[model samples]
Target: MKKRSVVSASLLALCLLTLSSFSTADTLENIHQRKKILIAVDIGAPPYGMLDGKARQSGSDIETAQLLAKDLGVELEVVPVSGPNRVPFLLTKKADLVIASFSITDARKKVIDFSNPYGVIQVVVGGPVKQKIGAFTDLIGKTVAVTRGTTSDMELTLGVKEISGVNIVRYEDDATTNTAVSTGQQDYIAAAMSVIPAVKKANPSRDVETKFIMKTFPLGIGIRKNDPELRAYLDKWVQINLKNGKLNDIYKKYFGVSLPADMLN
Candidate 1:
């Protein structure tokens, strides 16, 4: 009887140990089995994400995504997602991650998870230098053009509704909105300040310039809500890169200015 009991106990212990080991293996495999990370990029947002003239990927977000995939031991697939469909692509699992300039919002958080902000930029209303709007209140009765499906569009529309008499025009991308403002077809344009330098550089003769105005909000990388484990990995990875000065180096290389200490600290 004693011998039989010992044998049964040993068998139970072995099964439990095997099960435990399998669970651990499965968790690690989950992370590693993610062979390729699909990233979304807007071929429009410069200094953060954009496509080169030949349609090659090159930008801050591209470099950051590349380094992140390297750290995560995965290949990167950059998916071109414009403002309108970026979130839809992420929600549908067409992309594993979105390195696009996605802003973290309470409304957005309900659908997706955001990493700690990798970078921050203010959004402002821009117009021809002569008719510059000075503040959000000044925009109360004006027609504002914002990129469709972007936080800027949402925020400006909400702001307009709150203030009343404000009209919003949505475009598919920044370039179109900028062109609308430059041509006087739109009263004002809303976009990120990080884009200001590049847009001004691209159209020095347009007489277009940004007004301080009200801030839109900071931005962050977006991930599917089902992938908290992956989201946590990216959040920590961003901190690691920021701590080691890798993030700042990338910033300086593209923007020609060191990142603010607050971003790293």
Candidate 2:
């Protein structure tokens, strides 16, 4: 009887250990078990992610998320997010990941983890080629358009103080900001270089050209801070795709050019 009691106690402890292991499985494992992953992407940001003519989400970031889901052998569920809400969605558990052209910054690093940079983008000032603005200083006393609450808006807002009398006009979105510039509602517009091709394509008669680059920043996949397993998997995924030229292929499909060599570095 004593021997049987001891054996039963041992089996109970083993079962408890197994249950604890299952309970503490990392996020990647959970995603696999659930057979789906929720990805947050900015549907308004074109070339990166945006809505199609049918109002379905489609773009480079959407394609990237689809690839991730395929690799994971799971279903992809896209959650539309904006610039300010992307991080919030991740932190609030509304998204399993964010691939919304989120730039890697020291401040963001404090709140969320970023995977290895998968791409790079340039923030630039663009206007009619005939416009006299040549540099940041030239914007003084001129009105510049930018998407509200974006990095371009922040950068231009902060930097313009050096050149007194500049007027910054904030628009609700990039399309609106581009329209404001193309229609001469604003003298210049600050935007990502990636969006330039689309802008020119839409307004073929407009001679918009980059006046000067404001900044170049690397974009990374946003992940939860504590999910080391998921972070490691995503880092490896980026490295493999980058080395295999898959990422460049994707970029070319959207941007009409291969990824820049500097971006690879």
Global lDDT scores for all candidate models: 0.75, 0.83
Residues 1-265, candidate 1: write the lDDT tens digits.
9999999999999999988744421212443677877788876778677778897878888888888878878778888887778889987767777887787889989987788888765777776678757777777767878889787777667666657777788888876876676566875677876655665666576666787645645568887665656666778888898899997788788778876778888
Looking at candidate 2, the ten consecutive residues that score lowest on lDDT are 18-27
- Total clashing residue pairs per candidate? 0, 0
Candidate 1 residue pairs in clash (backbone atoms < 3 Å):
none
lDDT by residue for model 2 over 1-265, one digit each (tens)? Answer: 9999999999999999988755532779889999999999987788899888898888889999999899899999999887767888998889999999788877789988999988877888888789777778888777888988777877787778678888888887666777776666775788888766667777787778888888888889999887889999999999888888888788889878877786555
In TM-score terms, candidate 2 sits at 0.83
Model 1 TM: 0.80
RMSD of each: 8.5, 7.8
TM-score of each model, paired residue for residue: 0.80, 0.83
Q: Could you tell me how far off, in angstroms, the CA of residue 92 lies in candidate 1 after the best superposition?
A: 0.5
Q: What is the lDDT of residue 189 in candidate 1?
A: 77
What lDDT does candidate 1 reach at residue 100? 77
